[model samples]
Target: MSPSTSVLDMLSITPPGWGGVLITGAFATLFISFGAYLFGMTLGLFGALGKLSGIRPLQYALNLYTTIVRAVPELILIVSLYYAGTDGLNRILALADFGPIEVNGLVAAIAVLGFVQGAYMTEVLRGAILAIPVGQVEAAKAFGMRPGLRFRRIVLPALIPNALPGFANLWMSVIKDSALIAVVGYQELALAARVAASNTKQYMVFFLAAAALYLVITIVSNMLFSALEGYFRRGQRPVA
Candidate 1:
């Protein structure tokens, strides 16, 4: 931008303006967060089940996994996992005489964030599963329902209400956590804002724009989660 360029011109969507860049970055942020959250939820499901499965070794392993992940700073985890994961994959490929391939940035970002998210999600789900009434499962068993059927019909439905709030929180967390991907050079909203600020020398303007985008995301997410919670809690008695 020239010295004479107005802030409005710099933010315009047309030529030489970075509004388009910022919007694209915002979409990228959403994509990464959504993908990571889904991946984490999948991992958390098996993790929660294993933790509760009465297998000593499995429980210990999961315990260690959750403990280490939760204890470490998220930024440290992101940097470590981001490099370690791709390097580990290349190492395995090298053993077979295969050429090392560059992992896609989007995939790495999702995997790293998802791995971190899985630990918290596991505990959230475990607690929700435990909150389910034991009598419901026993009653299903008495009616000759198989374990899988029992979980599907009884446990899942019951747990959703209990877990929805935690799920909402995790969703919010991952959206913000996606910003850490910028440290690794992937161009999410934060990175986009930084690039714009650096080039235009309007740090405050670009950063506040990015902050507004994040606030919009948070507000929309809250409305969506509220609806989801209402849907899941249908027919349930309100807590007195």
Candidate 2:
């Protein structure tokens, strides 16, 4: 077969063909990453708040959480969490007199990735919060604004502009880390490509295609974040 024809055959989408499966896996990767981002954002928000609180113990605990997560290798964390999470869930179910529940691939991916990303995000958010001038927070308090109101009106808006660049970088890192979840047998883009290569013995082609797809995702993400950063910077002059 001509090289072009061979390449086309490899990409065919019929049964026993991997094109459709690989495409689906790519979307699955995106979905899992987004799920992790949402979970991490929630954890990060509370974790940052805890670190900023007046209570010494809470601050120490939150700091400890961030330190442990940041220090661990992401792949090690994912693998350990996958097995441990499943075991913990089963134990909980057994205690409740329910049958053992299976941990699905997507669920495992989200759980592990979220916890890992949340640790980094905690630092990102905490730094952003600290970047806000003390006067701003004090001003809000002086107005007798409720805690929630102060956070919503004064703190959150200010923090967002400064936090966005760091958050955007972390978001990209989460997407890349999703590739590691393949070790847990999740059929994400990288895993699918590996399967296709193993079956067809076209390792270079399959992996190169997967790399292309990842590059596209990264480029698009960069563009989106750049736009966001520019939008946030509008009307503000750069400090010398």
Candidate 3:
């Protein structure tokens, strides 16, 4: 058969094609990235707040958390956290006389990646919060604004403008990091491509397709983040 027909046959979604496998894997990747990104944001927000909360103990604890997570290699963190979390949960259950329960891979993957993402996000958000002018917060306080009110009315708005670029970077990082899930035997885009290549003995074709899919995701994400950044940066004078 010609190379064109061979490529088509290998990629075809019908009987022999692995296209469906790749598409499903891509969806899984997106789901994991989205879930982890949101979870990380929640953790980072609290982590950032804790770091700035003036409670020495809380600040120390958060510092330890972020420092360790950022220091470790991400692959090791993912594998270690994935097993430790599941095993620890089962151990807790076992103490209560319950059978070991299987954790959902999706949930486990999200939790692990989110945990790692939170550390970097903590610094990003903390820096952003720090960048806000103290005078604005002080003025709000002088106007009888409660701490909560000041945060909502003044701090958050200012924080986003500074935080957004970092957030965008994190989002892209998470998307790529989701591929690491495959190392723990979870079948995402990379793994799916591996399977297809192994079956067809056409490594280049399948791997290239996977790369193309990833590129597409990155392109779309960049567009979305650009739009969001534009929205947040509106009314500000352009930087020289």
TM-scores, all models, native as reference: 0.96, 0.96, 0.97
lDDT winner between candidates 2 and 3: 3
Candidate topping TM-score:
3
TM-score result, candidate 1: 0.96
Q: Locate the minimum summed-lDDT window of 10 residues in model 2.
A: 12-21
Cα lDDT tens digits for candidate 3, 73-184: 9999999999999999999999999999999999999999999999999999999999999999999999999989988999999999899989999999999999999999
Cα error, candidate 2, residue 136 (Å): 1.6
Per-residue alpha-carbon lDDT of candidate 2 for residues 58-167, written as tens digits (9 for 90 to 100): 98888888999999999899999999999999999999999998888788889889998888889999999999999999999999999999999999988988899888
Candidate 3 Cα deviation (angstroms), residue 115: 0.2
Model 1 RMSD, rounded to 1 decimal: 1.7
TM-score rank order: 3, 1, 2
lDDT of candidate 1 at residue 124, scale 0 to 100: 97
lDDT of 1 by residue, 16-120 (tens): 899989999999999999999999999999999999999999999999999999999999999999999999999999999999999999999999999999999
Model 2, stretches more than 4 Å misplaced? none
**Which regions in candidate 1 have their CA more than 4 angstroms from the true location?**
1-5
Model 2 per-residue lDDT at 60: 87
